[model samples]
Target: MLDFHTLAEFSRANCVSICAFLVPANLLATVLTIILTALHRPLHQIWQAAGFASIFALIMVMHVYSWFAIGVVMLPTYILLWLAITCLLANLIAILWRRRFVNTPSLSNNA
Candidate 1:
């Protein structure tokens, strides 16, 4: 039978491993999302921007929490995540603003 301490250690190790896996996956997904947005302008609409921003923010929070919980001190990693989230939010706001205010001229005006 596994002792309490051994069980605790296993749980901690599992959490750390999961965090390690998630960090890279989240990063890759973020990068891919950015690339896809850039390559396809239509896909970079306001709603999509907001959705991506939220997803990026969620990933950053998860990474940070995981790092802290796992007792890792990757300062540069934390900074990068913060920067990515900030940029995402800014872009999302700009997109929402444009979508809300940029009205197109209606064809009825030509009559």
Candidate 2:
């Protein structure tokens, strides 16, 4: 099995490429989701955007994990991991909230 050292080395070697793709991807996904939310767009549309954001968040999580595996616990790494987790959890909560509460009809109107 591949060890943490090996994974860390691999991540380090490809750090430039990883950042090139992930930086822009994460930025774009996050911006789009925020814009969609601000615009009060449809729930389905927001959900789709959040889905993409979650994918990027998962990738960030893996990248952070790789660094952590090598015992590199710097502030930047910690912030990145925190951002990823926050994005993922926020998206999940937003989705669940929309499904469970936003879509439900009020009972007072039935009187």
Best by TM-score: 2
Give each model a TM-score.
0.43, 0.68
The lDDT per prediction is 0.57, 0.78
Q: Candidate 2: minimum summed lDDT over ten consecutive residues — where?
A: 94-103
lDDT of 1 by residue, 1-111 (tens): 757556445545575564565556555655554554454445345456556556655655655655566577788557746765765665665554455444646488879
Candidate 2 deviant stretches above 4 angstroms: 1-9, 96-101, 104-111
> Least lDDT summed over 10 consecutive residues: which range in candidate 1?
35-44
lDDT of 2 by residue, 1-111 (tens): 869677677777797787678767776786777677666678898799899999998988888888877788899888878878877877777666556655667699778
Error of 1 at 43 (Å): 11
Per lDDT, the best of the predicted structures is 2
Residue pairs of candidate 2 with colliding backbone atoms:
none
In candidate 2, residue 77 scores what lDDT? 83
Q: How does candidate 1 fare on TM-score?
A: 0.43
